[model samples]
Target: MNIDQLNTDYGIPGNLTFATGKGGFPMIHIDNGKAKALISVYSGQVLSFQPATETTDLMFLSEKAYYAEGKAIKGGIPICWPWFGPDPEGLNRPSHGFVRNRLWNVLETATTADGATKVILGLKDTEETRGIWPQTFELAIAITVSTTLTVELITRNLGNKSFPLTQAFHTYFQVGDINRVEVLGLENTQYLDKVDGGVEKTQLGAVAIANEVDRIYLNVTNELVINDPALNRRIRIKSSGSKSTVVWNPWVTICANMADLDDTDYQRFLCVETTNAATDIVEVPPDGEFRLEVIYSIE
Candidate 1:
């Protein structure tokens, strides 16, 4: 469904309201009594989320972020589906699949009993998706905004055969200072270093940033807390149906080369993605479904 149809069907008081956002794409601005959020219909991406108690938004959006069709926005929660990171095959397609760069149909919207707003958006496989990755599938993202922000992506296979899949809720978190941030929960875990040709290494202590970091922690089931000393607050991240957790920051060198990111933008944001990558690849059976979800809250 297009933006007009969505506005006509499920528009409610203190729920998703249709409006044009960056790059003239239709977006849903939500204010459901407790929290506020912005979701882009183009990618079903939650671009901003802030609870009532916090003065700052939990998610970050790049100033130079591209908002045009088929271009991935720099920040927020970008869905990396069917495959994550570089082309799984030798096909040299987009880095994080094509789903995030396409329009998603708004399927449902409602206010729950607790006055939280819930919105569901979906996308199905067509000939265009098949040309890149051959599969019949249906993908939907369900977001609930209240005291905490919840985002869940559900994938269902529509084909008769099984298919391999890897995905991530590529979430960028806003922080006061990247240098003063410490990520807790992945300590004593082994990670695959993406910057060093996927070499394996074990984490020694709480993750502290001093330089470029790109690692995927394997088999993690713990809740992560971003301890921001500068902000004097902690952001809690809890997830389910994910085995790998990715922590990344471009630092100085790579940040300078990215067209969509400002050189100093890396200082204000860090990515701690809930993912299924490397050895945690998922095999979806015929007519089967899989889910990846995460919750962000302030403490």
Candidate 2:
């Protein structure tokens, strides 16, 4: 949608503005008292969020990330829906799903009682979507930006048959130094080591960065804390309707192969995703719904 149309349709009580961003994409810019944020109208993806009290952005976006249509931006929170990771049925369509690269319609917008900007963006099944996955559905993300950032992904099943779904909020968090960062709350959890061919393994201690690491923690439903000594702060991640978490860093070798990332880009960010992957996939029946949420705050 055009910036003028967004201003007329979604602008709220606070300072909500719209403009053409990188690659000629439409974006919503918020300057409420508590925080500042930028959200892309194309993917309904949050590009940046920085509270007024914080010294740096809580979310991270890759400097070399592509900002064009049909290309997934490499940072902030990229929603992986319907199926996470590779094509579940070996269809080889897209690695994560079609939604992240598609344009989502603005369904609603409002200013909350506490002055937070709330936006609801939606995507529905079409002939285009059915070509990838044959099902009817309504997917929407409700975002609240204030002192804290909260994102809720709502999925409503409109088809008559049940469908299996796995999803994640693939969040990229900015860090002072990846080697000096630590993640807590999964000390004893068992996880699938992706780098080791998805073998089952147990986490013996709090997560620390050093080498390439990629794991999916199973049956996890608790808050996680990323302690950044270099940054002198902690990021608290809380979620609901999610039972798994993914922690990953491509590190040196893989980062060099990725076109969207710099060779050393892995040193500045960490991914701690709230997910419904592996054995935790949800089976949604006709007219059923599922919600996956994540809230971020400073500590």
Candidate 3:
């Protein structure tokens, strides 16, 4: 729907409104008493979020990130649905499924009892979607903006046949300096090292970025903390319905090659993802539903 139609249907006075964002994509802007956020209706992606008590945004967004259709934005909490990473069937499809680049319907909007702004966006199977992956399904993402940011991805299988699914909340967080940041959690956990030929290794201590890092920590079910000394704050991530976590930073070389990211952008953001990836895939039966939720808060 157009901005006016969307506003008439789902906008919340003094809290939520529809407007055009960068590259002319429709966006939902929210400004409740406790927090502020921006959601791109084009991709159902939360592009920006900051609580009233925080000095900076909890999420990271690159200035060079593409805002055009069919291209994924470079930051915030991107929904990598259906599958994560490369095409599981090796058909050379988009690196992370088709949903991230398609438009999502605004399902609902309201103010929660806690005074947070809640917005739900959804997408269902279509002829175009079936052309890419033959599956009848419905996907919805509910975002709550309050003193903290909460995101929930819901998937329902509408087809009779069961399907295996893997996904992630590819969240990029802003940090003052990469060198001074440490990710605490998953110490001594096994992970698949994607950058080193997919070898399995155990983490030794808090994850500190000194070079290109790409690994999917396996079997994790705990809260992870990003300690940013430069920012003088800590970002806590808690998740449910996810056993895997992906930690990645493109660093210098890969950053230079990415069109949506600046060369030095690697030093400004870190990706700590909540995922159902690697061997942690889930099977969704006909008429069954699955949920992946994550909450981010600053301390």
The top-ranked prediction according to lDDT is 3
Off by over 4 Å in 3: none
Local distance difference test values of all predictions, in order: 0.91, 0.91, 0.94
Cα lDDT of model 1 overall? 0.91
Worst 10 residues of 1 by lDDT: 1-10
Going through the candidates in order, what is the number of backbone clashes in each? 0, 0, 0
Can you tell me which runs of candidate 2 are displaced by over 4 Å? none
State the local distance difference test value for candidate 2.
Answer: 0.91
* Positional deviation of residue 116's Cα in model 2 after best superposition, in angstroms: 1.0
Tens digit per residue, CA lDDT, model 2, 118-208 = 9899999999899889999999999999999999999999999999999999999999999899999999999999999999999999999
TM-score of 1: 0.98
Candidate 3 has a TM-score of 0.99
Q: After superposition, how far is residue 160 of candidate 3 from its true place, in Å?
A: 0.3
How would you encode candidate 3's per-residue C-alpha lDDT over 145-166 as one tens digit per residue? 9999999999999999999999
- Residue 223, model 1: lDDT of 97
Cα-based lDDT at residue 76, candidate 2: 91
